[model samples]
Target: MGAWGISTFDNDDAADWLADLSDHQSLALVRETIAAALDADDYLEAPEASTALAACELIAAAIGRPSAAARKQETLTRWIAHRKPSPDTALIADALRAIDRVLGPESELRELWEETEDYAAWQADVVQLRSRLSH
Candidate 1:
């Protein structure tokens, strides 16, 4: 049992892949994970939310968001809405909060959110960002 319905083996493979990624590659992975987590078809859940939050924290650190780690840690500690009426709501809420707190107004994420509330459109930007992973 793993995030996004992926198997334990898949999780291990992803972890291994991440370990070999550069900063930009890591960012791309995070962006992809976030987009996937939010996909309505995928049905976002607690594990996805947790992974997205961790990705946010990682990107925040890479981009120099000093308060990100603390906020994420605190939020995770208090997060107990795992198997409730609906985990998606809580998960999405946490992910959004983490994004807001982790990334400043000047961040690409903040800008994208401001530009369009559409996940698909934002994911397009994420795809574009992924192209820069090799640079």
Candidate 2:
């Protein structure tokens, strides 16, 4: 609950923090964070990147814009190609992992993702984890 930008809180704290926020407050925070991420020279290295991307996806869903996920995925792919072997690789990987966690089963957004035929199949292409826990 220290900041809305990262998943730094424990499960209960995160739940309470989210539950306590009004929709307007959440949207404003997320939008401001996203603007910051977008303005940064390298979002892959920016501390706000993970939260910004996830927030963008969530905000997009809230407003009925389904293309946000696809846009973010495209951005991630470009970052992967450009940043591999650089120290920033881990940051991009972590951001993807965060996105994966946010889109877990129980989320209505997860259902939207599942309805897409090849979204899950493209995971390996997007991130290079030999196994779920290996990388």
| Candidate topping TM-score | 1
Q: Which stretches of candidate 1 lie over 4 Å from their true place?
A: 1-26, 67-135
Query: On residues 36-100, what C-alpha lDDT tens digit does candidate 2 reach at each position?
Result: 54454422332343344444343333333323233444433333334332323344344344444
lDDT per residue for candidate 1 within 16-125, as digits (tens), equals 43343333322355556666555624233434444554554334333333232223442222221221112233343444543433233434333434464454554443
The lDDT for every candidate, in the order shown, is 0.37, 0.37
- Total clashes, candidate 1? 0
TM per prediction: 0.33, 0.31
Backbone clash pairs for candidate 1 read none
C-alpha positional error of residue 59 in candidate 2 after TM-score superposition, expressed in Å: 1.9
Per model, how many backbone clashes are there?
A: 0, 0
